[model samples]
Target chain A: MNVKIDGKYYSGNKGETLLELARRNEIEIPSLCYKEGFEGLGRCRLCLVEVIEGNSTKTVSSCVYPIRDGIEVLTNTKNIVNMRKDIIFLLLLRTPNNGYIRKLAEEYGVKAPSRYLDMEREEDCILCGLCVKACEKLGTNAISLVNRGITKKVSTPYDDASKDCIGCGACAEVCPTNAISLVEQDGKRIIWNKTFDLISCTRCGKCYSTEEVLHHIDEQLGVKTQEYLCESCSRRLVGEKFKEAFQNLI
Target chain B: MAKGIVISPDKCTGCRICELACSFIKNDSFNPKDSAIAVLPYDSVGLQVPMTCLQCDDPHCMTVCTVGAITKDPKTGVVKVDDEKCIGCKMCVSACPFGNMTYSSRHEGVVKCDLCDGEPQCVKLCPSDAIEYKELDGPLNKRKNIANLFSDVFGEVAE
Candidate 1:
């Protein structure tokens, strides 16, 4: 199906979202919560676009809006620009110190927030829930967005060290504002208030994974390896076997 | 039914040719670490066990996937992961019981044996005929008979 975006017709496949098609065609659509390969949440309204019908235009979040034949979309109209500015202004107020949010606010021409009444509420998290979504998708479900309204924030159950968390760092990797803190120090990984011992390759002496994650892999997969070599070292070990096998030919 | 790779650990010489072939064909590199099939060696017993995905009738990876990215095709019986739909969450990596699911750091996604599109490279390259791709009905039936016999022996003892 062909859909018009910014007056240009772009062909898209069935079940393709407007934002996905736009992104495939190299049209920039800024979105905070919508990630590729995951279902679109439409929580962050940054990718809102105006869909034009007969004598009427309806604003929709393009990330979750599926495209149909002959649908015309205007991405950066005056109304959408104003609405995006408002969203960015609100984000700026919530995450006053986040560099990513500040950059978005600056791009949308939102100046420094004048209201200083809630300085104590200043935080770095935008509460976009990307980290929570990533954790759930990984089947761990270790972290979630807890609380309600203004108090809502992502945390482990009871804000304690999660027993289910394997210290894989998927949540930290998916956080848009880098709010999830996962630090490595002294051969241990600290995340969600839990410290996990890092496992180093027996051959290369490079820390590759954590002990808890390896144990989790063992429990689920039911296959155990004798050695603790990293991927590169293991590959090299396999190469040595190949060398020994074809020694006569070489 | 679909053909699957079967390994005979006794026949394996531990040369690691199957790993080289699989990794080179699938990843365009000669890295055994990236191979879908793994050859584990036990020096004490002098045994080499080649492990790969069984593509089970009810795959745990498919059931635990939150985004419905992993699916087993009914016609081909090939369990596959859709790269376009996968979120690099590693859910399937932990769900597999046989340690067959692999998460590639280079590609940033989980990958597993797709039977090499029905011609398993490891089966072809195995020098000792340790790995074979064929219908598993005979082996499965024989294993079921042995299991029944063991259950009979243990059931009487328990009673």
Candidate 2:
């Protein structure tokens, strides 16, 4: 099969995906969720490439779509930028807290969708299949997709305690939105911290605890303080936390 | 003896070359999603912050790994994931404060910055020169001391 990528023609196998062909020729294509050895989920949409031939042009996920004979692939184009931006914008809407996705969105000026989709924005699972692939490829099978269609989620079988989980923490690491947190507490391995913390410092006049005050002061001044008072109050409050040191200083 | 990558956010431009170079060198492909180092952007603020494993002296990832798949490289001070030993538990991923660790869909193992064997591709490819690869002890401490002094004198305004 003949494929023209960015005006450069190359001979490729008939069944090969555009990503596979491009990698074989050392041509760079940006992707996030697509891995070489795993099945393509085409969820991240980071590897969308434009194919143009004759008067027809369309954007396709290069990871799943196979390269056809005499097809021309454009890796970078204005239309591609727009499409990618829209896809990324949708992703951002779902997982707005992710710093990595936010960076990509900013790079392309991805605007927030005008109409809200009523989708749950609680977590940032781009559903890229990293967790699922990690389980299947790594032989752990600790995580897999549960449900079908819009209700699908990467989860353990039957939501039961996974017997195959070796506690590698691979699923939590690959999550773009930090939707899953794998934690070890009291000898039990569990996924937690899925909810975003809405806490903000109240900026109360005395919000910092005694220990916090000392720690912050020590960090800032490069000197250890045994007292709990703010810099101004420390001179007066030194009697409680620092008896010997305050006496000596006095 | 373990070397680490130090990123100064003030100098970062969010070019994402670090992500591309890292994924390319480690995985032999150009994909930011596979890269160990992830660059997070605050679009409204026009700020880009590159995050990766600090390979901390007391690493939370290592402490949290139950099967001990994640280990510290004594020579370069990088935390490495042994694919064969990893059970895909995702514990270390949650333990990391900076969110630097990434799970590989292809490898079924959690991946983090290994400093590229002391020749970091991220530092080489970063257009804004936001990242610096250096030894942890002398240069890093010296730089931190300087930053501390500046921050101390200027208060929070130094940031």
Candidate 3:
């Protein structure tokens, strides 16, 4: 499909959203709730754009909005910029410590805190839903939005150690606020409420897989292997087997 | 996900982070008075229980809204007020069974937990994991884990 973004006509792929098309054309639209891999949530209204379809024009979230032919999208208009500025300001009030939100606020020249600042809650989740979505997509369901209203937060089941968690680290990888982290300490891999015994590579002696993670994987896929080995070592064994077979054939 | 936050009252230590987080997002301040969630600390016994909306299956506040302002979100199962339709009647405030709803003097309207659009902040920042957000089918995860432990150790729940 062909869409006109900022007066520049560009051909977009069939499945690409407006945000993808705009970013591919070097148009950077700020968004907090949209991730490259997941479905567009459209929670954060920062990526609002005025789209003109001949007779009618409406402002929509560029992240979830589809890019189609004859759609003229205005990304950085005066109104859009002001709306983005307002969202950044409110986001700063909620999650001031988040680096991504802070940098966006700085770039938009939001120097002073909003009068909503007589008091504040110090948290870094940003309510972005990236981590929660990532965790759910990983099929662990370990972390979710817990409680209601401002008490809402990302946490494990019953706020206790997650028995279903596989320690995949996908949630941490996609988190924009850096609120979650996977750390190895004392031969154990820990994230949230679950801890696993780190398994060292057979050849390189480097810790790679956690015991709980491997067990969870086995439970999910019915794998019965007992030996603990890293990715490279397993690859090396396969490669060595291939080499031996080739030599015998020769 | 239509989920609810389950609190393990025994684990609470009165840090009040849930209260701070609640008020900050709701009123843009950390004052617990404005928070929808509260940490009720038993001063004599030194016990704290964080309380908020239960997302009841049949909410009294929703039924009592004369102007039809209070409505339940089908997606998240959270009961919310339609501000434009709300006449600030405070009828739902009195109808709430748990008293989680409140009348805000500054805003001149009744306020309650809307589940923060399904991303509650209090559950996110609870240090002791006293609060948990999950679906209704399998809410008490910790209790289930304990039951499993007991089965493992004692070999049966009952004869």
Candidate 4:
């Protein structure tokens, strides 16, 4: 189906979201909470696009808005820009110290929300829930956005170390603002207020990953004989075998 | 011939100059954590292996990417992450069994070796000559040469 975006006709497949089509066409639409291959949460509201429907116009979160035949979508009109700016301003207020949020605010020409509101929140988390989504994808469901409204935040169940969390660091890796703190030092990996002993490679004696991660892989994917070896040690074994084979051949 | 970086583990000194060079060239920083190539030191075996993306014919990272952000170019055989489409999901990081794929917090994306755009910094800066950027078939040809010697000695048994 052909969808008109920013006055350009772009062909989009059925069930494709407007944001996906826009991005595929190299059209910029600022979005924070939308993750590819996951259901659109529409929580950020930063990807609002103006949809023109004959006599009426409506603003919809383009990340969730599916493309239709001959649908006219305006990505960056004056109204849409202003709305994006306002959204950025609100995000700035919520995450005053976050670098990503501040960068977005600067790019959109949004002033500091502290000046007008006279109130500043010290929290750096924008509650985008990308981390939560990432954790859920691991099938652990370790963390989630808890509470409601202004008090809502991403946390493990009961604010305790979740046994289900394998300490994969997927949540921290996906966090836009780097809100979730995951620390690794002294052969210990810490995340969500939980500490895990780093597993050492049997061949190399180098600490590589957590014990839980290996156990989870053993249970879920079945165990391999060289599972305990680090990437390089196992790879080096291949080189050694090649050397041995070459010597025999010669 | 398709080019690649081949490592001789015996020659590697575990100096990690490859990691530094790669991180500096790619990310303009000196952090090994952000480097595309990693040197894994095996202290027990007195061996070090410089590991990077293998540019597999069938990549696990590309398969696990939910958003289709990761693709392998058939012409170059380089697997790459499209930054615009990547949502920083880090699924590729977990999916790679060899731990070659890295999730860089600074870049906020999963990054792997692209052979430094056909001029590998790691191979250039490797002082020991353990890491070499050459034709992928170079080692295979050596093996084939030795195999031919066997054929010559056996005089091709009648099949």
Predictions ranked by TM-score, top down? 4, 1, 3, 2
Model 4 over residues A121-200: C-alpha lDDT tens digits? 56778888988887776677899999997789999988999989888787887777888888999999899989999888
What tens digits encode model 2's per-residue C-alpha lDDT throughout B29-143? 8888788877666555445557676676667667655456778876666777776456555545534444467666686666787777678889988887789887656845765
Q: Which residue segments of model 1 deviate by more than 4 Å?
A: A116-122, A215-222, B1-159
Model 4, docking class:
incorrect
Taking the true A–B contacts (Cα pairs closer than 8 Å), what share appears in each candidate? 0.12, 0.11, 0.00, 0.14
Question: What DockQ does candidate 1 have relative to the true complex?
Answer: 0.09
Candidate order (lDDT): 1, 4, 3, 2
DockQ of each: 0.09, 0.08, 0.01, 0.16
Of the candidates numbered 1 and 2, which has the greater DockQ value? 1
RMSD of 1: 8.5
Ranking by DockQ: 4, 1, 2, 3
Comparing 2 and 3 by lDDT, which wins? 3
What is the TM-score (0 to 1) of candidate 4? 0.73
Q: Highest DockQ: which candidate?
A: 4
DockQ for candidate 2, please give it.
Answer: 0.08
**For model 1, what is the C-alpha lDDT against the true structure?**
0.77
Tell me the number of clashing residue pairs for each predicted model: 1, 11, 12, 0
How large is the i-RMS for each model, in angstroms? 9.3, 16.2, 28.0, 7.3
The numbered model that scores best in TM-score is 4
- Predicted candidate 1 versus true structure: per-residue lDDT over A1-250, tens digit per residue: 9899999999999999999999899998889988877768888899999999778889999989999898999998999999999898888878877889888888888875466425555588888888888777666789999999988989999999999898888777667787878899888889998888888988888776776666655555455646665554553454334333323222
**How far is B111's C-alpha from truth in model 1 (Å)?**
14
**TM-score of chain A by itself in each prediction:** 0.90, 0.64, 0.83, 0.94
Give the Cα lDDT of each candidate: 0.77, 0.64, 0.70, 0.76
